[model samples]
Target: MPGEDMAGGAADTGPEEWADARLRGGADAQAAQDPPETVRHTGPPAPGMVINARYELVAPVGHGGMGEVWKAYDTKLRRFVALKGLLDRNAMTGASQAEAMARARREAQAIAKIEHPNVVTVHDQVETDSQVWIVMKLLDARSLAEVLRSEETLTVPRAARIGLQILQGLRAVHAADVVHRDVKPHNVVVGEDGQAILVDFGIATFDGALAVTQAGAVIGTPEYLAPELFDSSAHGPRTATPASDLWALGVTLYEMTEGRTPFPGPNAWEVQVTIDTSPVPPFQYAGPLAPVIEGLLTRDPRQRLNAPEAEAMLQRLLDPRAAIAPTPSAPPPEPDPVPVRRRAPRGRRAGALALGAVLLAGAGWFALPLPGDDPDEKDGKRAGSGGSGTRERWKDTHPLLKIGVKDDQPGLSKFDPKTRTYAGYDIDLAYEIAERMGYARDEVDFTTVATDYRSTALKVKLVDLVIASYSITEERKTAPPTGYSVDFAGPYFEASRGFLVREKSSRYDIEDTSDLQTLQVEVCTARDSTYEKWLPEAGFKLVESPPNTYQDCLDKLLDRSSDIYAVATDDVILAGYVKENPGKVRQLENVGGAEGYGVGMRPKSPLLKSEVCASLKDIMSGQVWEDLYRKNLSPLTDRKNPPGLPDLTECEVQSAGP
Candidate 1:
């Protein structure tokens, strides 16, 4: 009872959320178990305090981070309702207040858009001069928190029924790619008729937005937070995925049947570590409801039961004739053991399969030290580190990535127009990125993209990832919507600027860097190429003719329309022209470059960069990258050893400053 108020942490609703840590667990938890702070008579509101002229506040039922919730009467419709709106709007400064306002409206609109019985109905959201009020269907109810405090532990059948309804609501939320990051008993309201409705999306988040919580902190209750939350920091930005929510669901169900939370701690960090390390205790009273609970509670997001799978598992439990058996199929061989010490016992949940524990024991997870808590570091690794949940998130939405590869170019990504096939190191690298991102080869759909259209295709999202020997320049990377506004996976291959010109052309008269100023070399360059910036800076006042591709430059050179076929592209690409055209065109000699080839993606996608860089680094560390280079670029290399892998450090996204 001493730490009960502290244990029930408030759900944070952006900058507009009520500014108090004690107001945790959005609704009843903040009022019932914790201090009321300065809120007066949180019992019933005065009759005359109407909100937005449409709903009259009858009583203050509950309140939390997203301000006060009232039991109200809709004056227009003459029906009972719940009124939820932000707090201290005028107190907040400009941008912070605006973002919170947008977040509130977004949550209201998203939940209202979905039609599901288990989810509460959002009727309308009205913005006033000072505040915003969201009107929702009001149910005459005592919360699950009230039931838990009174009943202690629920019967197995009752808990399952409650969990089933909650899962249905979760399915609907996840279908919209939204995550209710703080799902606890406090957020659930059990109506008088025994219907449990999920409510309060104050901390609910969509995949499109970059970060869920603030930089260094996680928003949910300490006990219900998943182990994966510990892995994320400002260093490794983490968004809330449904898998994290499912972990909360498991904890909620556990609390319903067990009376006390599975992991009890005086502080939030200890609770997180306990979740990551300690064994999930056996379900004593949750008879047939054990498998899904254990499955959903796993630290590894990949192994955790997803929304659809968890829904199906819960559905089978509801049907009396189809009681689930843990191992309906034959037992398989034991998995190979993991490096981390698996000291926790394998408590029984489902039948003999012990699938969750057996796999968890061999899971081989890592945990890092949090500054002052750095322990005796051993074997160059730390215990209780968190896992990245990005792969599981991608599987739900964009498992099949549309990759942009050059259709006609050789050596990098080449697509045969007539044969309709793609081959080259860039194509191989794209498939490798998909593989490390938890996708199979067939899951990738390759599209033909010329060099000029690469940036455009990625900007409009016609392609999810592009690996067509793209350059990594500061200008392209900094360009807002059209350029490197997205993340880059590599400098997987490095190249310097070079020109492909005819042997008989006057371009050979250029001896050194200083000669570029005097040479009136009429250079044909590609549109959107970095040379547009690079050429003038390097003192080349050459008359520029922009084309769609370097191939077009070669065409102009061969047709005698241009004095010099010029480009500032990878040496491998210039070599391709020389290899294909015999003596017709040759690369400019002694011209070295400071550029690297990169895999490009949308601006705000962190996972694309994280997983892509992970895969690129992994392949380069082993024989895989060398083999890829030998297979595709070896022809261009003329059987010589192709360039060693680009420096791994070049591909990494620099950690934000502390």
Candidate 2:
């Protein structure tokens, strides 16, 4: 087994002897590549002289596409280490070989110079008669890809955090002008401490060495390659851009979230075409992972969110009410407790620039009022504080906190008679937050928008949070950098944009959406916005029209104004308008697959937001969360009840409380 572990100990035989035996025994294809003597050296190196006796190879740890990795002991320092070797045949070729060696040397230099927790530190690089090797810190855990295969699946937030950590490492590499062109699951090794250590920069190249690659030799795994790889440029399949790594990361995320790649095929070629030509499947069928997939799979590179953007989304998904604002470690207080200043007005560009800088510097706390009733009571009130005091007082009462959800209905905030207030799932979540913060349910203002306005509303500061079952992903989070924040909760309900046709309509015979032809599509404004980017890529003609709520779409179907109603199933289920409506509506059997719903918030609202997250966590800790489901959402519960945990203690609530 090529991947099997080679345990600790000294073999009585030398490298050449073992290699000859293995070759004669016909060991694996990998063994066939190594000369018998090289194969003998494959196992942990027996005591050996290296670089005039400064270092020694102790054991072989692992092997990959390029070479074998060894666990070595540094004789001078009395410490353990990892040594990587490049023994691939092409490394000994002509000019291409020299270019490869130069690239390898650059990667070694880059890894050695950089210092980051997530990045594996390369200690030294050395070349032997038959190999090029890099000495690095020995990692104790398996590759992340292996860990995932063993563990099967991880919670969305958990996986996202791991991904963000990996991105952070990649960011450092990119900062050094190194693109980890081979970013993939196997390259990320999970250490014993549960941190992700980015490893194997074997094919990584500095920006200066991008031209080293030969045509037709893809530097990355086909499944993870970016669509731009198909571009007939000198730069291999996918051009080696920092963004290309991000795209691979997106594919990694999609696979982890959904338990399968967004584009799957029997072989790599089919997958490559799908990557370059197909739209990512909707995440609605992904259950709890829906929001995570959407965020990571955004197609546009500029729009592809990276570490900082991903960190925000992960933190939110993990703890929704986490302060949306970036919380850098606070600095020491200003001398003599000078009164805090106000954000400069936008009229003076310098003032706005300074204000923005101050906020980013974590001095925004000085601009926001502390948890106090009035500013006049502070000792510095007399020090030209009136102007700042008035604004701070007003802001305390009217914190720019708000949530905008996507709704196409004429009156989205209709009161629910069953719950005795505005009580859709989205409303309930938002209402609970507002109620705890001393606002009547109705005090939380409602603003309706088409799907496209979702990002715009957040960017313009028209909304502080969006709880309208929005799908969260890495791509969307980066759309308006520092504008929107997504923290996912219970995916609560499943939703997707699928075709619904009249039972008697001529197109009713159309089974899957792919089967429909020359058809008029009736879509709610919200559904249209989501599908506009996805459906056309899937090859469908989208008939643009005025926005309609799910109920309106159903009505239009009965009236025969449109041929098919494409809408989210949740809206369809909630509207109850599709119930036995003269056989006018039936969801396509294999149409839109799975997608999920999540809460979205502005990037800056941390105060009440963290509190809201605490409340949700609190609810999820006990039967209250499950009861919300057992009462209202029976269809979603697992067939076998998940084993219950210890009951929530008062301290748990207090500790978890925002």
Best candidate, TM-score-wise?
2
Question: lDDT for every model?
Answer: 0.62, 0.52
TM-score of each: 0.44, 0.46
Model 2: residue 86 alpha-carbon error in angstroms: 4.5
Model 2 scores a C-alpha lDDT of 0.52
Best by lDDT: 1
lDDT per residue, candidate 2, 1-658, as tens digits? 1331222222223354423343355555344333223222323245443432444565567676666777665544545567777546544566556666666666567767777777787787877544567777766667767766765555444465566667777777877878877777777766554577677776676755535456666556767766555454423445676767877777777665445667776555787678667878744112323333454555544334444445444444444433233322221121222232322334664443444345423522112222223232332233224555542222254543456653322122233334333334455556665665556644565444334345544543345566664654555645444234343433433554556565666544455555564453444433324444565566665546433244555566667655544543343243333343435556664354544554565443433344555555565565655544443333322223432332322112222111
- Superposition TM-score, candidate 1 onto the true structure: 0.44
Cα-based RMSD of the predictions, in order? 18.9, 23.4
Q: What is the lDDT of residue 212 in candidate 2?
A: 43
Error of 2 at 376 (Å): 42
- Model 1 agreement with the true structure over 315-402: per-residue lDDT tens digits: 4444422322222122122222322221233454343234433432243211112222322212112112224632233444554566
